[model samples]
Target chain A: MIIDFHAHVGSMDSIGARLTADAMLHAMDAAGVDRCCVFNIFHADAAFGNDLTARFVAAHPDRFIGFAFVTPHYPEEMEGELARVFDHLGLQGIKIYPPYFDRTVEDAIWEPVFAFAHARKVPLISHSDGRDPLVNPNHGEPQMFVRWAEKYPDARIVLGHAGNFRSGRLSSIAAARRCANIFIEICTSWREIGSIEELVSGAGADRLLFGSDLPLMDPRIHKGRVLTAAIPETAKAQILGGNAARLLGLAA
Target chain B: MSTSDFPVFDCNAALGRRHNRRVAYDRPDDVVRFLAAAGISKALVYHPYAVPFGTMEGNRFLLDAVAGHPELVPQFVVSFAVDDPDEVRAAAEAAGVRTLRVFPKSHGYPFVDWIAGPWLEWMARERMALWVPLGRNPEVDIRDLYETARRHPDVPVVLAGAHYSNYAAVWPLLKALDHIHLDLSRFDAANGIERLERHVGLDRLLFGSDFPEVDPKPYLHYLRHCGLEENGLRAICRDNLERLIAGERAV
Candidate 1:
């Protein structure tokens, strides 16, 4: 029943900086996880599309879930990348770390990727977590997500950390109630003043997905956050994996 | 467990006389409430007021208030640059202080020099420890502490509130020394634990909260979530702190 949706198999494999395919599977077996969505770092430019992630999922089809690491900044490969990722790599969805690309969802260059994801029903998982004036401030505001939801009404774009660092902007619960299309990934932002309640009240329970920005952070901690929550079992199931299953077209 | 559930000994609360958001010990009752919520039985607290310059009022305020609050274990940072050995001895005796905390103003001169030979000798003689608070705006490099540790083999030099996980410079020096202890006073996440344990080994690491700002429940929550062995978790949560506390003069 435990499915970790966000985990990294980094460029170098170690327990901290890298959680390679084999390491992830072994850790999963040790930790009692049924499945995990494995992501890869394919260099800075996004040159190689899902090579590592695909290889891992392909090798362990029963255990691993794949997400395509696509660069919308590379405008030419939008549709081609989607087809390649979904068709060739067997990725269930697309993972776009836009801030790393220095691009935004509103960029004219990002249109084709959004369109392709919507058409094929592939979810977009990305990070919106950042804050503090001196360092990396978060790029995706809840309102920005609301705008995207309004634009791509059907596409399931998951914003990690319940759109945290953006929590600085939530000011109050009223501000949080603005976005809907954006599902919140429960991982890093599961700390103080955050939980399934905040997500449910702000963005509805269906939009909240369970994620563990694992190996970088531990899954046991992230899993415990979901497992020991004061919410209903149905809500827990939805956040943990049910919603991710539906988005990835996995049989629920 | 609630995020606010554990007993918190905030290693780094700057006492802004009238506490707003920044300081935890500003409201003594809040400290009591924080410990109660998180199941933290006790805490080792530091006051922000005396740290950079070494004032007695904030240390006095904390130690006195915490005395009534048995849950709070207060520590004073003795001045690094005492001109007189008698004053150094007097200050050490006066405060019943744990660490002669230093400020690396760089130009703060002779004071910086004071810690290495005589003051360090005095500190070692008194059996009081020397610690530098590593949390500041312009970060004090890990190398500086490593160098200081190099010069003084007999004196125990530790870095309190030293949780810079991304950096790698401090590792070798930490590994080289048997006496050096790193109070992972602000290990905000559970995931960072495995990496630290791998590098520092279990005994050298101590559990400290930059509490009130960091709720104890998150640590306890990290305890619930970390993929560490039961003994490792127990060491981090209670036993590691006990190891450090056992060495100190609870005077």
Candidate 2:
């Protein structure tokens, strides 16, 4: 079961120059992805937030797993907005774009959102690639992710694109062992010299999530890379679909 | 151990501080392992941190990583941190380095201003080869470099990350440099590999994987399935990188 965790399928107007929904779905079909976690493009569209994408995912529940993207920069409305997505649209997870939203993963604005997710047992994910150091110095650093996990131990946090654009080193992730809920997603780091294997070894199988930035990269190879990785089958299985399913409360 | 076959030379790898924390690529062993699994026997690795600050710190770390294991990675593209042509030659001579590479954006320096001018002159004069990455973000001013190359009439500059979208942007520039080469990194866009080969003769293009960020499998799959002539594949996949690093010291 190839559940690609990072994908966006919508109009160019919504995604601001991306594959159309049908085109994205066809691309997914061609790539042999059975299902995908859907999110909106990180942009400034007022109506194109979690609610729209979550509703889209709800319609194709079989083909898509829904994730709502929230702007943590707007701390005042984060909690209410998150509640709207999860409660009204059945969004099991929330996607955070630090670069787009211009806030570090560890900002105080996320405190309420993280608390709500922890209370609701929904997960929070970010798009970072260890590139952005401060993420948004005007806001905060990406390492502030630790504070989220540390503060809300029950809230699961996912760092996407294998933690793109300003993620810390593996050792630092290891050092922050207190945030056991923190998981890393492998989407953009397919052919990367470093890999999710290092993160899996550092954190554990339980903390790794599989994502394919699909319609952007090939999904077959995305699944193939994980399956062909030098890890045990159990870990591969977990990353492929198990972890996401269990995280989303799809199975007991 | 030809780098072109299952090549693992990562072009777009990076380094930086995050949240008052640093996610650095100063570690060499891990890099070696990374290249190895990417099925790369040798690599032309670059360091983002060292280039911007004009520090040899990351480059030296890479040198140390492949010091004893010459078989693992035999060559690297010398970063533009070395200023003096005498010193650049000296450092390459000292480290046994060859094929200098420059990151126009990561270092936040216009290639023309920083070494592109004097450096192109040196490369032309000294018969040196350089890997110039061209992309949207940092925005390679190919017009400037190509114009400079025309004036110098000798430096060998190869385009590292040229994609289908912006290849046209560099079209006017490509005319000036008889020696400028383009590698097949983002072969996904229209007129991808097959188209590029047909448009520009096979020899002008090289193969590279901007790894640890973009996957090589898709690019490899594209090339393998693109139905290029075997001669074209051989030229791109192995022959070009081999020739670029051809006369350079094996150490």
Candidate 3:
């Protein structure tokens, strides 16, 4: 099963990324993707975006796997929403956007969600681009999450986009090497040659997951990076779906 | 090993040390092997140092390194640093080089008419190809380069590493001029290839991998599945570049 661990559905206010569930399904079918673990695009209101996500997933359960969007700014109601999405709505994981809120991944505001996800054994995927000069540079730096990883040993944290920018993949690899809990997702506009190989060599094949950043980027480009990698087919299998399935506790 | 059903000629490949990163292409053989591994038939290459350091030294190394490798055609990196017009023209002619790449942003020079005026005239008179590195940096002025191409209509100006956002600007320029072309190394925006082919037509489009910094396999894979027709794919892959290269020899 080829699973895209990172994708987006619904409108984004910031950069104008809008992809409907029908559009997402068409793109997935074209790209030969079996399932997509999707989240709402970046939004200030988590509830509104999460509602769209829940409806999208509920409509196409087999094609889409939902990840609930939560923010620390809503600290008063963050945990309640997390339970409503994951427990009631049947979302599989939690997605966090730190740079959008002008906060770093290591901020204390994330402790409640982190603790909850740790206890629940759900993967926490965060937007971890090393670019974005407007925001704090450390906002998505994979190294910033090491302390959190050490604190919450059970939480499976994914650095989405693998710190998506130039030379950011190396930092993501470094972060994965430092913390066993952090896995790197390969989905970014920047496609440095041998980047996937570097991730496989620096971090194990098991610590890597395939992501398309879909609707924003094509899934085939990300998938081709793995399918044509010089690595063995077994490693490609792990990257394409096995590792992501393992992370989500699904049959590979 | 070519992924596409059609043959491809990469227009924006590079050789030698890449700036700010560890690249696989250190020697000419490395680039040749890299292209061969990707099943690419031909590539227009340059020494990465030619961007930072002036072209005189880097071009010499590039010409020598790719001497025997026909698959790797050397694209001479020239800039205003070599002020003498005769020297630049003589070096290109002696080396049998057809294409010249300029990096004003990386080489720390302004792309003004005074600096490029004589070269532009020389390129037009000689029918040489002028490859301007654009869209890699936000500060790169594609419109200014478009104006420069307007000054010398005879010279074929190829915008290497053009961003997808600049594709809109290409039509207005292309409507007036036929010498302008866009290299698709960094043009990976969603539905980018299909849209460009529809709006600008495939005749002006050229295949580019930006190798050494990026792998060619993915780009080849991308173009293969971008839903282009066989003739359109053939034009982008090989025919368009063949015309460009042939124009150089016809000079």
Give the Cα lDDT of each candidate: 0.59, 0.59, 0.78
* Ranking according to TM-score, highest score first: 3, 1, 2
Can you tell me the DockQ of model 3? 0.32
Backbone clashes, each candidate: 14, 20, 0
Q: Chain B TM-score in candidate 3, rounded to 2 decimals?
A: 0.88
Look at candidate 3 and tell me the lDDT of residue A78: 89
Residue B227 of candidate 3: its Cα lDDT?
A: 73
Residue-level lDDT for A162 in candidate 2: 53
lDDT of 1 by residue, B48-118 (tens): 66654444655667666766676666666545454455754664467455555555553153333335567
Q: Write the per-residue lDDT of candidate 1 for residues A163-252, one digit (tens) a residue.
A: 553343242223235544566777763244335455666666676777766655556556656655667788878877788777776765
Model 3: docking quality category: acceptable
Top TM-score prediction, candidate number: 3
Candidate 2's clash total is: 20
What is the C-alpha lDDT profile of model 2 across A120-142, one tens digit per residue? 88877776545443433523233
What DockQ does predicted model 2 obtain? 0.15
DockQ of each: 0.25, 0.15, 0.32
Displacement of the residue A213 alpha carbon in candidate 2, Å: 3.7
